[model samples]
Target chain A: MQQNDYTYAVARIRFKETKLLSDADLDALLSAKDTDAVMRLLHDKGWGDGTSHTSDELFSMEEEKLWSFVSECIDDLSVLDFLRVPNDYHNLKVAIKCITRDIEPNGLFLSDSVSDAEAVYEAIKNRDYNALPEYLRDAAKEAMTTLLQTSDGQLCDIIVDKACMEHVYRLGKESENDIIRLYCELFVASADIKIAVRCAKTKKKIGFIRRAMASCDSLDIDKLSSAAAEGYDAILSYLASTDYRSAIDAINTSMSAFEKWCDDDMTAVLKPQKWEPFGIGPIVAYIIARQNEIKAVRMILAGKVSDISENTIKERLRSMYV
Target chain B: MSEILNNSGLFLALLGAAFATFMAGIGSAIGVGKAGVAAAGVLSEQPDLFGKVLIFQLLPATQGIYGLLVGFLILSNVGLLGGVEEVSLLKGSLYFAASLPIAFAGFYSAIHQSKCSVAGIGTVVKKPDQMGKALILPAMVETYAILALLISILAVNGINGIQV
Candidate 1:
């Protein structure tokens, strides 16, 4: 489709962006006395549906509201498969484990996945791979078989996660939109980096690390796998040669800090789209930004519930898109 | 051949007027429709901003009026409305040539201006207080359309005075 086709959607997203919590807003939420105060503050900001809700209820409602608003703006929700694919894979993981371990999958599935989680579970339960989406058919069958035959849940997870990354990367490559392509590249590359770092810390063999990491143009899976097998210092040295050199500090600080850096990096990349007036870029950026905002709020609420220090929560907060 | 030549000039002159009005009108329709979609989107979120967005939607509509004005001028000049019913082939062709500037310029400028207006509407959606700045960007596109209008008007008047 032409870029002009998204003009109306982009305009609405522009207005919606104004409602996103700024850094100052995050500070206020962070400094709030307790969970109740945080909930009250969010309610004042038009969160939830003008009803009393617990923190989880409020966050879930807000997430649903974001998707509904997006659905209202966009005629075809498949254009957002990049965002929904992860949830689909997550559900797949949950379903596989639940089926293997003989447990109910209640409350484990995410809402708004590209495919229905229960449907996925049923298809898996019936051992009918064809019922699933074509992109997911092979991965589902392989992961399920690997779990059943080997009784290795970790191996099953690696298979599913790699498939998810590959599918996401292929979708990105096929997309004509630049922003989607960039997002997918970053998503896979970041995931690979995280996998490599974890494997390095755990002292995994090169072959195992190679099996888990997905390949993308931005990062070489072979070099990354080798670096991961070598150690943390080698991984850092390898990252310093790539576009992700700036992420070294976060990687050095803590795993959580690195996670925050990855999100903030995405925010920084999407920040420019705020000024963009026409195209899918701004709309995609807004969706990601809203997701980021919700994540930040969830973190703050979780921290408050646990009585974590304000400074620590502040440290983990991501840069807002607005 | 001579009969065809004698008739062809009036046909061409009328064709020119039609081109000017039709092309520009199509452009304006597209431009205004695009801006209106954006306006509707904004209004859906904040209905109070209707007055501001309405102005942005109307900005692209002026190109159609300019096209109509030029078409009317061409019709009157060619005696198609009310005047001596005969004219030399040279004068008819001259009138046809005169309409070309607006015909092409109006068609392009309106569409480009609407893009600017749509972007401007997005600006207004975010920062209502910055309407003045937002409006100016699209209005700048008007300068080119007006320039084309001036050239077509001057050319039509000059053609009328020519004694060929």
Candidate 2:
């Protein structure tokens, strides 16, 4: 692309980033009496204006309206393209659950970016194995096998989730674009880190971690698996060897801090590197920076709603840059 | 021919290098000037964040330095520093062609980069601390100019038998 067009894109992006809720905006949103006040607050910022005047009309009773408004302004198809992996996995889980429970597909089908929803639905409904992707076929087979042997639906969910993570991890590694690769890597790493922390805190057996573990682009899976095998303290010891060492003390025996650490560190790493020349780094940086800002605002609002101390909230906030 | 080549070639190469460097510098200056004005407008509205926005305004200026460095490298390699006056037309034109892309691209991109930084500064009008992230967008854009500068420098040195 020409320099002018790239500048134009950055211009649009800057405008979009500014419209995102700031700390003051979050404060107003939190102080609102109801969803009505929230709508009015957003309306003040030209949000949902011209279409919905009433608060009741704007209230995202089902998350659809909110996502639609967001989708409207940030209309880059790439965002939807990126989200398909997670949403598709969710849909597959819903499908499998429906088939086993003998439920109808009416409310169960997902609105995410499926090329042909009917095809996936029919394939699942009819149990005609050839229609599905190989991975999905494998997952369905594993779910059925697990179901028949153990009669444990939770086990199926775990297996499917692990399969989904593995797919995402593979996609991250295989991606040719550096930005997409980094996004996928951070995502997989965060997921693996979360699972490891959860298992450690819950004292779940090593078998559960092994079942859930998928390779990530950032952290060494072998080391993580070994830590899981060795136990919680050992995992902490291993995590301490990375840039996340600052988080070890905070985590102690808790997973929350570790999760927060991953989020912060990912931003910290990506933020500085965004200054490099060329090939989607700036775009990725801007998107991630905006996401971080949103997350930070959400965190602050959550704190305010709970009346948590400012100091506590500050301590819990993730790094603005990776 | 070698003597004619040396005199004209050296003059043309030096002229190309100087013009390219000047052109790129002018473009960057114009870009940074515009961004600086916008930043000043923003800073006036938010006095406390002047320091942050100013850095963003200055980032567009680096392309000029890069161009100058490339120009200097080319000049040094032609034995211009050794006080040899002029040489081959072929060598000089080759040097000119080699240096032109970065200089021109640097000029155009620097101007564009500043515009990005300007828009970014506008974003910072309400969010002061985001200035660093905002400036990075332009810096990323300016990176091509730096790479071009490096390539031009390498190419001019790599060319052989100009006869100074």
C-alpha TM-score for every candidate = 0.98, 0.58
Largest DockQ belongs to which candidate? 1
What is the C-alpha lDDT profile of model 2 across A141-248, one tens digit per residue? 777678768878878877888877877667666666666676777677667767777777677777778787777645787788678667788888888787557777
DockQ of 2: 0.07
Task: Show model 1 residue runs off by greater than 4 Å.
Answer: A1-4
Candidate 2's C-alpha runs over 4 A off are: A1-8, A31-39, A46-82, A104-119, A133-135, A176-179, A201-205, A269-279, A282-322, B1-164
Q: Model 1: what TM-score?
A: 0.98
Q: Of the candidates shown, which would achieve the greatest TM-score relative to the real structure?
A: 1
Q: Quality of candidate 1's docking, in CAPRI categories?
A: high
Q: What's the distance in Å from true for residue B57, model 2?
A: 17
The most accurate candidate by lDDT is 1
> Which lDDT tens digits does candidate 1 get at residues B1-164?
98888777778778878877898888899889989999988988999999999999999898888889988988888788987455668877887777777877887888888899989988888889999999999999999889988998898899888787
Give the worst 10-residue stretch by lDDT in candidate 2 chain B: B37-46
Worst 10 residues of 1 chain A by lDDT: A1-10
In terms of lDDT, model 1 sits at 0.89
Measure candidate 2: CA RMSD: 9.8
